[model samples]
Every structure is written in C-alpha cells, then in structure tokens.
Target chain A: METPCLVMDADLMEANLHTLQAAVNRAGKALRPHAKSHRCSRIAHRQVQVGAVGICVAKLREAEVLALSGITDILLTGPVADSTRLQRVPALLERAPHLMLVLDSHETARILHQSLAAHNRSLDILIDLDVGLHRTGIPPCDAVSFARALAAFPTLRLRGIQAYAGQVQHIRAFEERRTASLTCMKEAGQTFESLRRQYPACTIFTGGGTGTFDIDIEIPALTDLQAGSYALMDADYRTVQSRGCLTPTHTFTPPLRLLTTVIGTHHPSHVTVDAGLKTMYRDGASPVPAEPEWSHLSYEWFGDEYGRLLTPPGTRRPRCGDRISLYVSHCDPTVNLFDAFNMIRAGSPAETWPIDLRGCSQ
Target chain B: METPCLVMDADLMEANLHTLQAAVNRAGKALRPHAKSHRCSRIAHRQVQVGAVGICVAKLREAEVLALSGITDILLTGPVADSTRLQRVPALLERAPHLMLVLDSHETARILHQSLAAHNRSLDILIDLDVGLHRTGIPPCDAVSFARALAAFPTLRLRGIQAYAGQVQHIRAFEERRTASLTCMKEAGQTFESLRRQYPACTIFTGGGTGTFDIDIEIPALTDLQAGSYALMDADYRTVQSRGCLTPTHTFTPPLRLLTTVIGTHHPSHVTVDAGLKTMYRDGASPVPAEPEWSHLSYEWFGDEYGRLLTPPGTRRPRCGDRISLYVSHCDPTVNLFDAFNMIRAGSPAETWPIDLRGCSQ
Candidate 1:
C-alpha cells in the first residue's frame, strides 16, 4: 500500500456506494454525498451508511472535516466569503446540527448574520442561484432579491436553492450532458419557484455534479443530489458520455487508483512515474495507465515528483521498479493529493482512510 | 487572514531569500533550497537562515518533513520506489544526517541497501543523472555502471550527481533558457567528469532550478544550486526571459501571492475569485490579477473553488468583498495547495507559515 499511494477499491468502493445510493433512491432525490469527494471521514461515514441524506461540503474546511467526523448532515457547497470563514459558521453549527450554508450575497448574508448573530445561532441558508456557474451564484435575476436578502438574516435560515452547474461537469456530450443538465434544471426550477413563494423557509433545493448525476436525478427541482464524483471514478470521469437513462455506459466503477512506482526507465521510450503534478491532479487530464499492458502509455508532466510514461515504439515498456496502477485525472483534486486512503481489498491493502478533509483548502 | 489565503510577501520573502542567497554565493554555488518549493519548515528555516546550504526535498515525505523540522541537510529529489518509501530511509537517516538520496535504480540501490542494511545505517547516495529531464535520470551510458552498482552498496555512499533539468524549468526564451541550461550543463558536465573519476567520495554535483538559477550559476559542473522557485516567484516564473547575465527582466521578486475574495461579481465584466483549481496550481497557467488595478483582469479556472475574473470591459471590477492579489501559476504545485503561509507584512497578515511539507506528497 505505498508506491505513490491513494488506492481504495474496497469492493469497488462498496460497489460505488451501493450504486450511487441506489441511483439516488431511484431518482426521488436526496443523496447529498459530495464530501468534497472523499475528504474521507471514512468516505463520509460510508456515504452515510449507503443512504446519504447529507454531506455536501465545499469548505468551511469541509464543514470542519465532516463535522469532526460524526457527520451530522453537512451541506456547505462553497460561498462563505471569509470573515475568516464567516467566523467558522457558528463553530460549524456546533459540529453539524444539520449545518447548511450556501449564501450568495447580501454581503454574504450580512457576514453570515453577523457570524450567526454572535452564536445565538440559527444558520441553515442556501440561496446561491446562478445555475450557469458564473462561479458562485445569485442571479436567477437576483433570486428574488437574494431570497429577500436572505430573509433579512435574523441569524439566517432560508434553507434552499444552490444551483451548482460547475461548468456542466465535464460535458463530453451525452446530449451535451443532457442539455447542460436541463439548463441547470431550468434555472434551478426558477429559483426554486421564487424561493418557495417568497420563502416559506425554502425547503432545500441543492445542486448536482458527478457529471450531472444522470441529469440531476431527472430534476423535479433537485431536492438534493450534490453528487461528488460518483464514488471515485476518474480519468476525467471515464470520458463522460453516459447517456439518457444513465446506463448507456459507465454506471461508474473506477474506484480511485494511483499506486505508481516505475521510478525511471527512459531509454527507447520514457517511463519515470512516482506520480506527479504532485501526486496527480493536473486539473482536466493525464493520469491513465491502469494497465492495459500500458496501453501504448502516454502521461507526461514530470516535475512535481515525476511522471513521464510516453512509451510508443513497441508499446509495452515499464520496468525500473514496475508497480503501476494510475487512473486519476481529477477525483476531487486527486483526493486532495492524499494523506491517506489505501483501502484496497481482494487484492491487498485493506484500511487506511485518513484524508480527513485533506489540507482542507482553507 | 482568510479569503483564500496563501499570501507571503514578508518583505518580498526576505528579498527573495537574500536574492537567491547572493546569487548562489556569487556563483561558486552550493545553496540547496528546494524543500519541494516552500513545503515550509518555517520556509526551510528561512532558507537555512539566508544562505541555504541544505534542503531540497522531493519525498520520503519531504525528507520526513525536513527531518522533523530541524532540517539537517535534506536533498531527496524523488526516486525512492516505495517499499513503503524504502522503509523510511533508515529512519530518515536518523533524522537527516545530511540525508541526500536520488538513485536511478539498481532497484533503487538495492532498496536503499536493504533499507540501510537493516538500519546499521550509512546512506548519502546520488547518481540520478540524465539531465535533460528525461525525468528521473540514469543514462550517461548508465553512469559508470550505475556508479558501479552503487559501489557494492556497503550501506551506500557514492554521493555525487543528480542532474534535474526539470524540462528546462519553464523556458520562455532567454536564448532558449540558455540553450536549455547549457544542454543541462553539458550532460551534467560529462557526468561530473565520469563521477569524479570513479567516486573519490564524489563530492556533491547537484543540479539547478528556479529556471536554471542564472544558467546554473554559469555551470562549471554545478556544485549545488538546486534553486526552488527562487523563493516563490510564479505566474509561470513570471514568463521567464531573464537573459544571460541575468536580471534583464525578472530577477525573481514575486514572493508568492493569492489573497483572494471578491467572491462573485459578473455584471458588466465578471469577477468570481475565491481562488480555484483548488486554490491555484492549475499546472502552469491560470492565476493572474496581482493588481496593476487588475491589469486588464484575465485569470479563469472558476471551478474547484472558483476564480474567473476576466474584467476587461474598461477594467477595474473586483467588487463583492474586494481584497484581490492573485499571481500564482505554479509555485511548487501551488505550495502543495495550502494549509498555511499567510505572512504578508506591510499590507497585513504578519505571520502564519505552516505549510510544513504540505501533504508531504509521499
């Protein structure tokens, strides 16, 4: 369990967490998952023990590492706009009492209601709108005045409407990621129907990802999908294209990878390896070799701790110390360049996990 | 010190660590300074207190986080081939007895002489050759039979060459980065004159970086340099071009940047911010706005934690929460995507540091 590390495959990630929680509970929605893709509080408590009704996290340091690992329904999804992380969102709502927070602006809902109204606490939020990913939301023509200025922040509680469209999550075309996930579910179902008729505490709309999780579970105004990289499939989401009813292909099974070794060969066709771009996360591509006998190789970036590969001429290469594996190309910044996650199973390793919100990216 | 952190100007990083340690001690070389580019053990003990004769790590978990921060002369520079990192290199050479490692295989010098002959210790090594960045190294006709099979590894001591032309460190033309750093200092000066005529305890030939630290201090068989991003200049080494006698354009002074904020504006021009590609390191390109009043803006990546910017239409946008400052495009895998660093100085945030071998990237 070493070579450049990060393994996982524990029975193919518990069969990709029981096939994306039985296809987001057969599309009636509510899976949550996305703990910023395996920042591992034991894979967000095994995605809330396979049902996953809560865990999104984009950062309040991944909702304080999945709320100090107890994992009470998290949500975050970006937008905290720093008052040193909105004063740690009322101490991450005292370790995740269903903490929500997505905000888009009445100056970050008055700096998160003056840091949760000086901790008398009342947080929940959501409002982030702009479905097209202008990178941070608020603009379904100003989601009803930013959910009526985050319902005048008496410790902020609007509780719904995020609209994620992270640039159509790698749209390599399956009807253009289902027409851009139905145009971000028709503008987040018109800003969750005008903030559930002027805010009856807007009932949780959330967002979608893992390449529009089967067109955001057929979008009936997304009650909650937030999809984090379908239990670690990568190589840029295994080249997208999973069409309509979701099984035209890739029902997801990459189960992370990486391993590595082969620390240098280079003569009649390069080799190197020991991972790179600092243990693989070069944004959109390059990290393949899960051995199809080195499928004519390819890789490249050889600096932040080497990578190379190339190997064209006769094809098979790979010698120095050999090992290999690979896959990655972006599984949440390659699981935030690892601090743990070995796992494996019917082939070795077993348990390691620890990414505990890796570098948390504060 | 929050809005997307990673600051570090502290008097332009103590004047870029005393101008690259007085230009590698007026070209007679020996500076070392890499610590995998600011994996900060308090910036490698402030680059070994301004002169830097130690530190250049690439992994054994960044030489066990710079030998548990006392940093007793590191070196590492990749190629360990993991038997769980060659059994932690004789317990990191008992906390770095001037560590040094870099091999180029005899199966990694018999897995570091059977893990330092089962800890009876004795390490120092090197060999690693092939300078033109054929990643990892070896080929100078197999460096004298790989330093004569690492001198029959009686606990291994060779210690001479290491080559490292990391693809000629971002060559944006200064006589094509001095003819590719003088063709990697003429094949590492003919393999350091044939391994100093067969290892006369091969006195440290090392390599160079921070774009061939002024063409490897005019290469006379480089006795050390190893320049890690000249104390943090970025935006792709500020597009290189520093000519022969150096300093015609950028003689290092970027001193890291990132700050962030303006969390989404998008109106007449766009803005976003909250850093991106998981806080800047999009392998060689994106990050920019270190304000010339937003110098026609630009940036882009907008996803793994935002970024966008673009503001051209009559410029000057950055509205939302304001704060600005970007710069980055590569400062060692964006200082391994942050866990600390702040530092600043006259503009604020006086001292945070902590990137202590960030995710050590084993």
Candidate 2:
C-alpha cells in the first residue's frame, strides 16, 4: 500500500526454484535449497514441493519454522550446538521426523548423544568440512578423527561430509573461480571418500552455490549443491564468473525491486526519499534505480531515514511525488526488513506473501 | 518465546524521558522527541505525557501512527507526499488540531497547501535546514526564502525552522564534539536569528541528541533538543563522551538490551547466538554481552540468523542452554526488526510489548 514494501517477483521466484532444481537434476546430485535467502517458511515449502532433496537452514530455530511448515527433510547447515540450542532439537525433531544437522566439534557430538540418550536414537549428522572458508567447519583431514570421536556418541550418526565453497561464490575471475571451486570441492570429496571407507554407508557430500553449480556438476563426488540467491538475482550475485562453469551473470532475471517515493526536493540538484538504510541494505553496493531515466541521480547515504540522491547535472530531477524503483545491493537482509511482500506479476499486485518466518530472527 | 527478544527497560526509559525534559527545561527549548528511534505509538504517547513540546517523525505514515495515538503535538520531520498518507494528515489534524508538518521542497509545500486549501484550512510548516551533516535540509541561508516561498499558499503557515544536528550526536570526542556542536548549531542559530531580525516571531530553534544532550543545555537560544536515543541507550551511544558535561551518563543506564539464548555452541572455543544482523544494527558499533563475564567473547558478522561470537582463548565455554544477553549496537533499526519486545525488568519473565509500529518502513 505504501513505498518500501518488498516486491517479490513470484514468476521469477519459481524460475529460480526450477533453475536450482534443473542444475541438481542435470548433475545427478541432490537439491537442498538454502532457506536463508527468502527466510519465509512458505518459500521453503515451495522449494520442498518443487522436488528439493532437502532444505538447509542456518539455525536450529529456522529449522523449526520449516519443519512446522511440513518439510520433513532439512539440514541445519551450521554447527549443531550442545549446551546452547540443543534444547530446541528434540522439539524440532518431533515436529519434523526426518531432519539432518551439521556437527563441527567433538563436544557437540558428545552433548547431543548424551542429551538425547532417553530416545537413544542417532540423529542424522553431517561432519562440516572446512575446505577454505575460515568462518566455520573442521579441516578436511580432521574429519575422520572428529567422526570417530563423534561415533562415541552412539546417538549421533556421522552421515556424510559437507564443504561449502563460499569464497568462490562471488568470484569475478572465471578461470580462477573454477580452479578454486574444484580445489575446494576436491578436498571435500576426498574427505567424503575417506569417511565412506571408514563408515561403509556414507552417502551425502554436498556443497557449491550459484557460482559453482556448473563446475560442481562435473566434480563426481559432491552429492548436492546448496544455492539460494539464484531466484532473485542481485547486483552482487550477477558478477559471479567461472571458466568452464555456469554463467551466473544474468542467468536469472532480477525480480525484486524496492519502490521508493521522493519526499524532499528543496535543493533542485538533490532529492530525498522515504527509504534509507532501514529500508535498504548498503553493505554490498549502492541501490540502483531500475530506470535509466532516474539516472544521473546517484543515491547518497544520509543517515538511517533520509537518502540525499544527487541528480545528474542537466538531467531530469526527481520531484516530491515521484516513485522511483530501486534494486537493493543485497537481497537477504533487505527482504528481512519487510513483514510481508507484494508478490507482483508483470502488471499488477498479485498476492501478498507475508514473510511468515519473519520475527523468527532467532 | 524465541531466543532473542528486544528487552526494553521501562524504568530506565522513563528516566531518559525525564533526562531530555530536564535538558530542554534548563535550556528553555521545546523538547520534541524524535519518534523515528522508537516508532512506537505507546512510546510517542509517553513522550507527549512527559512534557514534550511535540513528537518528531521521519515519515508521514509514522506521523499518522503517532497522531492516531491521540498525540496533539506532532512534527513530521521528513518531507512527505503520497496522497494516501497526505489524505490521512487532514483527518489526523481533525483529531490533533495543532499538528505540524516539515518539508524541504517547494513542491511539497505547494501540494500540502493545496491539500490544506482543499480542506479549507491552513497547515503549519517548518523548513528543514541542512546543517553540516549535509542531510535532508536546505542550506541554512535559504531557510527564510524556503519558508517565505510557502507564502504563496495562504493555507500554509510558516512555522519557523527545523535544524537537526545528527553528525554531532555521535562525536566520540567530548571537547571536540562540544565545539562541533556549538559550531553546527551556531550556523543553524544564525539562520533563525537572521530570519527573526526580519520576520520578528521565529519561535523554534531545535537540535541536539543523547551525545550532545547536556552540552545542548548550554545553548541558551535553543528552544528544544530533539533526542530519542536517550530512552534506549545503545553501544554506539555508550561511546558518546559526555565527560565534561553534567549530562550524567553514568546514571543514564540503557533502557534496551537484546536478550539472546545461546543457540549454537558446537564449536570448541566460541559459540553462536540466535541474533545476527537482523536483530542487531551494525551501522554504528558492535553488540556487547550484558553479562560482564562475556567480556572476553566478541560478536562477529555471522549470516542472517546467527552471530558468531569468539570465546576467550581457552576458557570454559558457555554451553547451549546458557542465556546470553546482547546489548545492541543501535536500538532503532534493531528494534524495527521485531514484531514485539519483551518489556523487561531486572529478573523478570517480560511482558510482551507489541512492536505495533514495525513493518511501517515507509
């Protein structure tokens, strides 16, 4: 009804869902769509219904939201906690019976095993292999020892190995990104192979994103690719390049756009909009107005509530009532800012998708 | 209940309300608490009850929210135009007869005056003066011409000027910030003085923040200081050096803190919480744990739903079930992310304060 309402392109969203599925289908790998992008349970449900092998959530609480939405197969991609959020596990597992979790430490394995002793059932666990991303996960070589240590926890099952190549996701160099992806996934693949020989029934080895979806298809070992942003392409994701890999650039049409209204025009050369940092994310890049007509005007940051966009010299200046459509620098947090989305088609407002999983920031 | 909830300290919030009142009372300035910080009608109502001259809002829709809350004195600080929102303004005026609107554009004044004429009445307006912050305000020198331009619309009443010193608010150095505040506000003061020498009845000279609250008390000409962060001091505001000023920062404790439960602790050295960029504002400063014990651990940028906190080198780590309290970097946007807050007291179950003003991004 007003400016700053998140506009989701449902048609493009479905296209993104299918695109990820198509990649997984061709690669003969599993499709586990990460829910971090949309964060909405309804979107996760759609991804599941569209033949995703599993949905990957970043937190245990997020896993709960998805599980409550009737998704049975899910992987809480981050390290599963023992003392911190493990209390939510049983309830979450009860909501959705078949759920998998990632483990990166021995203490976690011990805690989960001991905590769930009453059930005496091994939870589906995947050893998070740290290939290159220094953020989290264990080193690939340390995967076996950790798995053996985790085996002591009879209730925690070491299912497979997962190594996400995030560093290669935004690679601008084509050949460099391809080599980087293969090198990282190769280590993950080797870890999976070593673990499989030890466990005899190791099945899952998943990694790769929109950037490596094409290259990962050739790496015989990765079981699945977890890519999320492919649906609503952003300016940042549009730059992903890799030699012999999929062209992430312009592969998916950009669907989401923030419609903001010009509220101030005192300085003829400068205009202010109702949308500011609170309405958009500026961590990645400055928001670009969709139309080139709104060009010559560069959006400038003016605190949290005001944006002083500089109008190009001799260009058409924005008036007080003009509605300017802008593309957010990043998609995830920008979407998180809105409670509901105006899921629009080509012409009119179609359906209102309440970001149902909103305020579930936990 | 979720792991992370906005914990608003009502008692401290009340104190901050009084603090602003005292600052303005001493300076003989009108205290118009900016509603942009809280965005809650309940909070706006409280500010009105506590002798605030008016409530300053960033958006017309937000002004509508506060106006509907039965607040008679209101100031829509930012320029606004949507017919839907502007249409509501006249009706809002019906409830609160003394509503004031702010504008930076001649176009806004024209449209607003047109709307006011259509309603067969006049509306009061303040020309937003751009100070050193170089934000959504006209240059100080053009304050009168901008104010005088609205004279064509007989229905629009020129109600002095609105100059907000946002840059001086976060000046971390005490003496330097004090000097900068004087210089910035002096520039704004000169505009009001020059206009008054010509027009005679220039009534308001408003500016100041939590950072310059006590310092603003020294500006004898300032009619009122518009500060909202005092109600909920944050990590960024915590660094506001008010050493020389009698503004009593030691006693002015923060009214807001994010209560987060340890969600992920599978890692050995560090742990992860359920709050991330979505629950915390990263623009100003980093979040800190409320507990003094967590001093060793620092929060890092974890993806959407998780905050990766590094633990003290080799200490006995906090377990999964541990409840860690997080002081948000900035209260405004962090509070905007939630649908509700836990109106918390020291050692309390917390009453749910519905963030009724949330999702009002426009």
| Best of the candidates, TM-score | 2
Runs in model 2 deviating more than 4 A are: A80-95, A105-123, A134-136, A145-158, A198-201, A242-248, B68-70, B117-122, B146-155, B190-202, B243-251, B261-271, B311-321, B347-349
Error of 1 at B142 (Å): 16
lDDT (tens digit, per residue) of candidate 2 on A287-350 = 7777778767787777787677888678888877688877777777788788777888875789
Which CAPRI level is candidate 2?
Answer: acceptable
TM for candidate 1 is: 0.38
lDDT of 2 by residue, B71-145 (tens): 888887766666667666677788778888777777667767777778887777777887766657788887878
Which candidate comes out best when scored by DockQ?
A: 2
lDDT by residue (tens digit), candidate 1, A73-108: 888887776566687778878878888878777776
Q: Give one digit per residue, the lDDT tens place, for model 1 in B100-150.
A: 788877876787788788879887778778766677667776788778767
lDDT of each: 0.77, 0.76
How does candidate 2 fare on TM-score?
0.89
Query: How does residue A337 of candidate 1 score in lDDT?
Result: 72
